[model samples]
Target: MSQPQAAVGAAVPRVDARLRVTGRAKYAADNSPDGVVHAVIVDSSVGRGRVTGIDTRAAEGQTGVLKVISHLNAPELPPVEGGFPPGEPLRPFQDDRVRFFGQPVAVVLATTLEVAQHAASLVEVAYDAEPVSTDISVADPADEPETYARGDADGALDSAPVRLDLTYRMARNHHNPIEPAGIVARWDGDRLTVWEKTQDVQGTVATLSGEFGIPPDRVRVISPFVGGGFGSAARAWVHSVIAALAAREVKRPVKLVLTRRQLYFGVGYRPAYEYDLRLGASRQGRLTASAHDIRTENSRYERHSEGVLQPGRMLYSTPNVRQAYRHVPLDVSTPWFMRGPGYSTASYAIESAMDELAHELSLDPLKLRLRNEPADDESSGRPFSTRRLRECYLAGAREFGWHRRNPKPRSTRDGDWLIGMGMAAGVYDTERSEAHASVRLDADGTALVQSSASDMGPGTATSMTQVASDALGLTMRQVTFRLGDSLMPPAPGHHGSRTMASVGSAVQDGCDKLREQAISLAVRDEDSPLYGADAADIVVRGGRLYVKDEPTRGETYQRLLARNNRSHLEAIGSYAGASESEKFSFYAYAATFAEVAVDARLGLVRVRRMVGVYDAARIINPRLADSQAIGAMTGGIGQALLEHTVTDHRDGRIVNANLADYLVPTHADMPDMKAIYIEGEDYEADPIGVKGLGEIVIVGVAPAIANAVFNATGRRIRELPITPEALL
Candidate 1:
């Protein structure tokens, strides 16, 4: 914004990229403390049953076996209260009930990794087998679905000349990163220290402190280096607690890393959804009414529901609308947030139904979407803080050759493939949270900044540093930034794409205050050349303050401090969300274009190219933001074409628990992906004039790909992960 300065809008490489790429960065598993004991978690065999007996005699007799802990022999712990932003506390080994498969039943401690592995197999468990009802054939969610309505949808649909009624099913997906979940916990009397793999270090500390009944200060969670989280590490799952408790029970430091298979059950996932959508529109593509019936799965112990009805109520300008969201409480593990959890699943249904409407009315898909863009967020009746969805649609269409696309299915072909192009609108809520930061300026003309925000491999630390540099009039090398420790300045947990908006603003705040502190000291001192100058008229460039009309009248901050006998100066700044979000409207929007080629004989669908255009407030780092968007598109392709977490309903066990059985996008499947960010700031959203982009990037991806498939083939698949069998 300021002539491409180091602040706000810049393409700066990550501050820690060298450490990460040089193999010098230390992840949690890389930490090896003296006298560290190895640990292994024994999981439940039966999906729904109670452990009647645990054979630990063999494990205890083996060499180097420190301890074997089960609910029968484990220590009494605090209760768990579950939900986000410090959900219910976690009590790992407090009970004997087996709620789902892969629930940790026992933890074995040994002197060596091999010894722990051998001893874990020796400690056996026998359970009373119960019926496993993990079937997805017919999702029978719980009673009393949450319902919302604004107008009479039934009456509008009855009077409309065009209508549609269709159902969509979404497959379960997992966030499998290269690094598995691990925790190294050490107990020093009543205090505990844990080097964990997590997204929210402060949240983990709070959960562990509450679970163990220890004071918050007694627990320290350090996660400087994380491979990748998606949403798996948002909270401290049961594995972390089990490892910490094992350390307390054994009187030694213990390290526990969940096996890849255990990851499917230990943490959370994107739950399966079954949605029935009904729509009414005019013959000219004007939407009149809509109805949505959504059902998603949750564990019996916890009542969780993804907000799949949000899109239907707001995306288009539909006057008559009714929606109900129901949760099916199955005997499965609790599901948590995944990338674009609600928006992705909901858009698939809404956009697919729109595609159906386009076919019936003989209208272009892009034209149909444009005809329905709401003048405002209809549900809230508030003007958007900013909306560039129209621009995205225009730009993406031009770049992807949308004008050349044939509306007729199976009309375009090249060699052994049928080529087609499709586009869909994507939307997501922006992030807003209370965040704080501290900045300290040393007399040597260098600056140090600290915050509680985290970098979940999206280059948050680097971006924050760049913001601090320009605000303080310092180079990137002159500023040192730190994160991922609870001891740093207090900040909200990083999620919802709010990190940059909230934390980056906080860093800017701190730097501004620090710079002001130096300027105030200089203006008040007669020894300084800028003595008695008005603070408003003084502008500091690279640590040297000068007057508005006279450049030679001011002196460097180093001289003012040296004459004042000061060693350093510091300031703490805080950023909070404004009340305007409630008074006005706020949402980030994107439009995606996808081109695909499907083999007519073998049903092999390969994407040729894809592009995403976003109106996500202001981008902090262009390069990193571009990468985030492209990676999100690639992930969406996986969700549309390959990703599925299969469960063996016969026994209520996840069958495709490992990478081999499950599928994700590899380099071979990657297409030529591109991203374009509209430049500007939404001042009503935050002080930093930015909105969130991470979650929205993937929201409309699956639908975009599905629409392209429909354009390529005459058939329209209703379900997700559209397999080759369906096409054949």
Candidate 2:
């Protein structure tokens, strides 16, 4: 028997790589609409104030200047609506109130970008300044802390034999993709077309339509390529709206691209966090209770928060657990979801506490986690769809040589540097939102599939093509998958690692239906070679429909379609979402191990190598999956040792707004990194059996490095970025 030709699990290259490398793939800023003019924004100088008056006389006098738009002259827009819940949206130029520093107060339109930029700088504004508080520590809580409790946490903590209380702080981080946030908006009569850099094309359409009071069908968003998002490009910001408004007023296309400095305020960033964790465990390393008090910073207007406490509630088996998440509204711009969101931040505190407990109990860190592994989700009391965290630990430990490590801090030395190894477990919820895909099989034996999903560096198009190619029994070259257009089938934005499980399933569903249509045609036709074959027994392979038991009785798709007079067969595939059966907990798990060399005298920490083993169910394109894991691990390294967004608390200004000051991992910083995936599939999680991989890879990375630093040096640092000053 011949096995089916499979592309789903193959290590296929990205379909769009050629276009990207050749600079042919059009980004948002690359598009040049007819009669396109340039637009540049003027930001407010004061952090918190109300604009008294605006003087645009100098800007208007500049040659090639089209218009200077500000609160004094810009038209009123409909009230902004629809975003992640809990906060009022910020509307552009709606009034004179300046909520934060660098708030967009005006825009300049001109014939060229330089002219617009020069004109924007000339616009002067007057403001009535007010006292501003950007410091997270000084800001009062915006609302009552949200609390969750399961058992008697205080009582359990008091009775526990071993206890540890630790406080950890993480600095704010920004998403600085090489391509800055940009938009090219064009208006034709009442219809609007925008080429935007966004993670969600449909979300942009809905947001723009609501803001403009236009019907949804009249707004079109095209974003086939996104340089990088890391969650910053997930929403439609005020710049996109400003571009559209300017285009409508000027009766021409308007292009606006945020500079590197402007990106700090133009888009949202990951909020800084102060996490206080109190843990209780038995003498034998059994977890008894856990309490987490988390305070995160956000804008004064919007209350932004992510899934921060989920790791505390579900990552381990604790009978008594309590959590309180408080949003401290500061005089700053709104914060948004970043890579790993809440789980990454929480993992640092929870996982570090676990490491401390291991040191206190004299048990191996991995063994301690293994001992407390729950049979089901302790929070929900539901069985897991597929939990292979134990497998990840075993594999990662074996690959990283964890058994050779000395648990005693500062014990192992390599001449001037102290050597240490540490490991931490990671978890991300399996999120599957509703998505739809359209697949069409042409009579010429080629197939096309499309979704409205965005590819923010995770190879969404490549992965979906692999799925469709396998499902439709077509070769890799015969299938092409397209995404990032609002006119295509609707898809949830690519975030929380949900694109593969949601959009991939829809592609599979749509391709399966199309294949069935061809099978029906081949079986029913009397002139076809497959006429006598049963439809159920017929299988399609290499564009040929043949009986499974008898391969010789077959006919080609082109021949079959020609005889049937069919030009093409199309179907719309849809995945409603995960079932509501309430029987299973679905999550992607990883075990991250790091080896670091710390110069105790000089306060220098260098990560020598790192290993990440993931049980992210059903590998689709192993090459792409590996790239995703490695990229995430690199970001994790940055979070642990390099990246920090320094803000000037006095004036609510980001001091390191540019890449030169705001550090990220360069080639010299990346160590010998390895990514490994345990081979398996979780069919219960979704149709394609893919547990998401993007977010899980970054979850435990920071803690692993932090724990390794502790192992290398006798001192333990709870704060993030593990600065040299702290080591000294």
**In order, what lDDT does every prediction score?**
0.85, 0.91
- The TM-score between candidate 1 and the true structure equals 0.97
Question: Residues 1-728, candidate 1, lDDT per residue (tens digit)?
Answer: 12125555778788899999999998888888888999998888889988899999999999999988998888888664554533233357677788888888998899999998999999889999888777655657777888988889989998988989899999988989888989999999999999999888888988899788889999988888788888888888888988889888888888989889988998789888888999999989999999898888887777756657778888899999999898887768888888887888999999889888998999999899999998898898888888888888998888888989899999999998998787888888886888899999888888889987777778888888888888887778888999878888877767778788888889988888888888889888888888888887877666677886797888876777788888989999789854643767888888999999999998889988999999997888899898799889989998999999888786788989999989999999999999998878898898778888789999899989999999999879988898888899
Clashing pairs in 2: none
For this target, which candidate reaches the highest lDDT against the unseen true structure? 2
lDDT of 2 by residue, 164-253 (tens): 988999988888888899999999899999999999999999889988999999999999999999998999998999999999989999
Which whole-number lDDT from 0 to 100 does residue 27 have in model 1? Answer: 88
**Which runs of model 1 end up more than 4 angstroms from their true locations?**
1-4, 80-90, 578-581
Which pairs of residues clash in candidate 1, taking residues 3 or more apart in a chain or in different chains? 80-89, 81-88, 81-89, 82-88, 83-87, 83-88, 141-328
